[model samples]
Target: MSTNAYRGALLGIVAALLLANPAYVGLVMDEPRERSPTGYTATAITPTNASDQRTVVNRVGEEEVLTVAQLEDANEYSPYGPRYRAPERAAESLRAAVESGTARTTGEGVTFTLRRVGANYRYLRTHADDSDAARYHRFDVVRTNGSTVVTTTRVNRSTVAQYLVYKDARLYTALPEYQRETVDEVIAADEYGYRPYNDEFHEVTESVVVKNGTYYVFTTGVHVDDFGPSTKTVVSLLLAALGTLALVTSIGFTLRATRERRDG
Candidate 1:
């Protein structure tokens, strides 16, 4: 009875902590029709000032180097600059191409294909070595249709693990609405697969369709990825620290209560 009571209390504490977390907790149902039966098309987003952006593909789990485009100028290369082409513009072009069946995404043994997904402003981070880098967040997709499940670790702006399993449209149609919805959210979160069930990160991950109008708020200095999960090492260390603190505090209190009982 004592052990049961302690376990219950511990769970209660965990629930309260998670409830206090700002990131909203979402529940997944069994509806499988949430996935959209849409095909993708590739659009060459070339800049007036062509620069080199390498498109890497891993086929059959074997890394393959595709043709890399060279950029001669940054002025008109990507609208958002060579760093980023702006999310809205890229999203618009890609969506249109796929809808028209102009952008047919294909490749065998290809687990991940990162076409020049529209480049977005990713804070150009600098290293301590005085080196400079212009990094941008890209929007990429993993093709799947029922029998061909493509699951990716979403790394957007959030604190959850998003596992997207894409298959044939025919297979997607058979999924229950809720199940499909869950899968869509997972893909949207992209890389959120790093942490799927954490509720205290203040990062709400809503699995969504690529076309869905979901965006993340940005903060200056350190733009926390509001889309994907954090590194596993960092997350695990945080949990361990919290666990140790909780255990110490609980033991201290129990010992104090036992001492009082003896004294009385």
Candidate 2:
């Protein structure tokens, strides 16, 4: 009836419209849904010589025999350190050994020689523009008795897409069709989701594979978030709640003013 009453009515109408907006309503009702595969298969093979000593031959025609721990320490936060150089030299030696039809052995009885593949390094260098290009390592497990060969097994490891090879067929087959499809697609393309974060790119997918009874796990260096309420949804719900409260208060004020005028 009065100017204040009319303004209250208008306020109530504006608030009601806001509360009824599809975007606001949708935000309030939004529920979390599955985004990606949450479960992962475990590795099938366990290494028996993890603690064994490894002899590394440097580029200077000198032998630098270091244990696994020492090798790790040499490369810790040091880019061009011994650990980094070791792989390149090891790959060269491996190539030489392979060409000469000889087995490169280290440690005691059963020797396991692990080295980065020279081809992968060259590929990465040639395709420097390709972000999906990854490095690979070659692992050879050899058994010898008094200079006589017994058995040997070789396994290839990819630094990026480790899950490319599923050693256990039954485990892979047990996965749901959708998951299997995703894994297969990632492996086939040799590419994983790379998202930009703070001026840097990060990998979002993780994978694992087992070969020759050895387990290898690798990820895109980014952790995938679980299903939860998104930031936008939370903000929408908050704004909608405020709008509803404003509508209710405006309606109450208008009704109270009308009753007062009638009593006057």
Candidate 3:
């Protein structure tokens, strides 16, 4: 009945409505939601289409989007490509194994050992230790003045009075590293199996670029969703609603107290 009550009710409704939809509030308040750029100078890979096998274009001034096969083709492939471990580290392991005379076995009982007298020698299990001895094979590490090589034989035999040196034969690769937060955000925004199903709804929030021959990373989130709102969306809305209710209740109590004072 009082002006205070009317104003309180109006304020409560307006606040509740604004709190219910943050996106709407941002739009009305002219607040842009674009993310900040990563200081690293590198391009980002962005999807260009809504296809299941979406094409992606490099954000570094490249407008052309490559197909799934095209992207795969662009990726370098090597039989001895860089892995998660360094090749030098693997070589160190080999040296340790040789010095210890006990090769590291992969629980299959297949042993790899190295020995160095005046000459270096390496041995690989042709089969399990419990297998037939006759079927076993031994390898000789031979080093010439020019080059080093490994020769396999059915049995250990005398060489041509040459020097034998163990050559590290393990393949190694450098592990790929990226911005963890960017990678996680992109993966979270993506559909299962990195599909493009969520592309129309979700998008990259921030682009994280790493230069100097390193992996580029980016962050993504669902800005708009045609399907039912995500759990995050629901929780955000609930929090906003609670906050609005609390503020509105406080304002109403304050106004009511003021009205009582004026009437007194």
Candidate 4:
């Protein structure tokens, strides 16, 4: 074979291998898979009158209210306190609650009113902790009936809230301020797990939200793969670029050789 022919063949082989890098990477790559929690379900309590004012009454008589600083100090020494096993964000939330005087009970026999806090919309599988293994959150809805106030709390899989949370986390930085606010408003208004939009990327096997006067519905089902670009992807892209260059060079050599043969 002529020198040009040999060079062209070598280049062609290199091009083919490089061009196939992406396919190879796709096959062997370990993509981050996120499946809906097992046994996803929800439970609800009977509705009460909306007019019934709910207060954080300590059921176990009066107890000493500990400050957030004190709790942290205690955790530093004991490390097995109530906040020890809690996620950092959850612990922070507890601290905030204590500081605000909303939650001030500790020790045995302590009981306090339960209120549904805002949802954590930026929840990601990568950010999951041991607590995520069996996650749940509550939502309360109140209605007024004549001179009575009715309220009900519904408990559902955190996966339900995570759908929107994932979206918000993914798009928060990219969206405009007004758009961000719009998203926040939507989340705030639909606190009872309503409007579980069908995400195109994630496969939502099951999703439903039932909230009305008589009954409340809870839905859960979604799988989110971590889409962040991996090292394999970056390498594949680089290989693709090299492959294109090699292929083009091979074509150039083949064309030159053909011209030489024709001239001879």
Per-prediction RMSD in angstroms? 21.0, 13.7, 20.1, 16.3
| Pairs that clash in candidate 4 | 48-150, 48-151, 49-149, 49-150, 50-149, 50-150, 51-149, 52-149, 121-165, 210-217
Q: What TM-score does structure 3 among the candidates reach?
A: 0.23
Candidate 4 lDDT over residue span 39-138, tens digit each: 1223231223211101110110012112223333434667555533333333344443433423232321111111111221211111122233322232
Q: Please provide, for model 2 over 102-199, each residue's C-alpha lDDT reduced to its tens digit, 9 standing for 90 to 100.
A: 44545331222243322121111111121233122232333346332212222222321222223212344544565445444433432343222221
Q: For model 3, what is the error of residue 213's alpha carbon versus the real structure, in angstroms, after optimal superposition?
A: 18
TM-scores, one per candidate: 0.18, 0.31, 0.23, 0.30
Query: Evaluated with TM-score, which candidate comes out highest?
Result: 2
RMSD of model 2 against the true structure: 13.7
Q: Sorted on lDDT, highest at the top, how do the candidates line up?
A: 2, 4, 3, 1
Candidate 1 wrongly placed segments (more than 4 Å): 1-233
What is the per-residue lDDT of model 3 for residues 103-123, given as tens digits with 9 covering 90 to 100? 332311111111121132233
lDDT of each: 0.29, 0.39, 0.34, 0.38
